[model samples]
Target: MELKRTNVPFLLSLALVVLLALLPVTKTWAVGIALLLGAAVSNTVPSAAPSGLGKMRKLALNTAVVLFGFGLNIGQVISVGGQGFWQTAVSLGVIISLGYFLLRFFRLDGDTMKLITFGTSICGGSAIAAVSSVMKARDEEIGVAMGVVFLLNTVALFAFPLLAGAVSLSPEQYGIWCALSIHDTSSVVGAAAFLGDTSLSTATIMKLTRTLWITPIVFVLSLRQGEKGKLSVPLFIVLFLLASAAASVLPFPVLFKSLASAGKVFMAAALYMVGFGLHRSVVKKAGAGGMLFGGILWSVSIVVGYVLASLS
Candidate 1:
């Protein structure tokens, strides 16, 4: 008889990630919840799933990005009036630099640390996925990095909203804050929801500005990795632009709205796959060291976010 590993633990982590994403936290210490949840789930599988599933995961995250467009308005995204743009850019650069150095100081492996840091400081789980594929990073490295981002993403979602209220920031300012601060579109949207529909609308624009950087970042990382080949960017990115354009020009609200909703569904499926495939042992073996490095990376991002928001 042959024995097979079912990957139950990994599945558990994937489910937890999705749940945290789905929830809207405000003034409830959502960060703590996200931390616990991220810790609880992930690292369950003995190995990566089949290639087909990997493709599915990639599709889901891309769809999530697209659906994200529906959550915002085209005109407002254009009229952000250039406040905090430099602040966001500067803060992002600083955070990446600081986190990268810190990880090396702690003697972590460079590639894994870079992937994790880039993932947390830039977009979130999605960025990590794109970079991992482009650079051919180990699955374990990707998993560990994503787990940390998942934790901080939740924290940003809940805590940022409360802070937004406390400071009484305007929609433009708050949108910039959310755009620059949170790691994922989900976190950005989740945090903005606490402020109201309009914040979600404006922040989406601010984030799109940041999301555009992923391609160039991937290209540079690929070059350094010597992972460069033909180096054509993903087709989905092209589709994402088209979707955004359609959202911008389409006169009918319903069309744009449906496109956005489709994006969310794909993301949800991706979340499910991540949860279902995780393993308990992998998470255990990840050790305190890896997660700690991820935390430091996340912290640097948060500080950068604050500076950027203030300047904006």
Candidate 2:
């Protein structure tokens, strides 16, 4: 009976993901609606949700990211990645350095500080999740980190495009800005998608380059802590690159296009799971200082990123 109860929510959630995927919703709307739906379901029957739901969410997201590669041009990826490398490295260093001072100023826990910093500087929840494993962070700390990032990412999704328009940024400039500044690949791509295809492509490639920084960061932390956690490029990123390479050579235009479209839907589905996982308790536990630190750090990152994007 307990097993059956758990299965019901899982199946229902799956159906909802598929249903939403078929709708003609924009990326922003899909993410927003899916999050609301997940929150509603989780809040209504919180206990009935499966414990493995988070893992499933990650799997869905990774798969979607890999599929997204099918749409990219290998030459473009190489060009964008090359251009963004130094900018990404410098940005990461600055964000982490500022985060350290803020950590001391706020008197927050070290583990939470690292988690938030990684999320802010790298790839939002993905960075937090990766670092948490090596750092052996408590569930609560991870929750707080993710919750803070989530709130900020949601704000960026809406505000960034409007900001870009107000500044009269070209699509390419907006793309670089979004890739440099935004928290997650999902949010970055979503915000850039609002601008146009050029923005979308540029943001995706540049953000993926930024994400590559996670491997070295995680590896160094693991060595320092003597934690033998798995150290490698995230599998999804490798697969995404492979898919891009194959798309460049393989003559599967229709198939690649379909997969890319499916990837967006799956990404939206993952957003739903992300929302469902962030319970109110977690948000409350994020604390005022943690929230302030993340918000302030993110704001500074935005300004710095925009400057770099303009100069680049």
User: Each candidate's root-mean-square deviation in Å?
Assistant: 6.0, 2.6
Residue-wise C-alpha lDDT for candidate 1, range 206-286, written one tens digit per residue = 676666667778888777778754345556545655666677776877877766755544554464454433345545644
Q: Which one wins on TM-score? A: 2
Taking all chains together, the TM-score of candidate 1 against the true structure is: 0.68
- Cα-based lDDT at residue 112, candidate 1: 74
All candidates: TM-score = 0.68, 0.89
**RMSD in Å for candidate 1, one decimal?**
6.0
lDDT for model 2, please. Answer: 0.83
Cα lDDT, all candidates:
0.62, 0.83
Compared with the true structure, model 2 gives a TM-score of 0.89
Clash counts for the predictions, in order? 21, 0
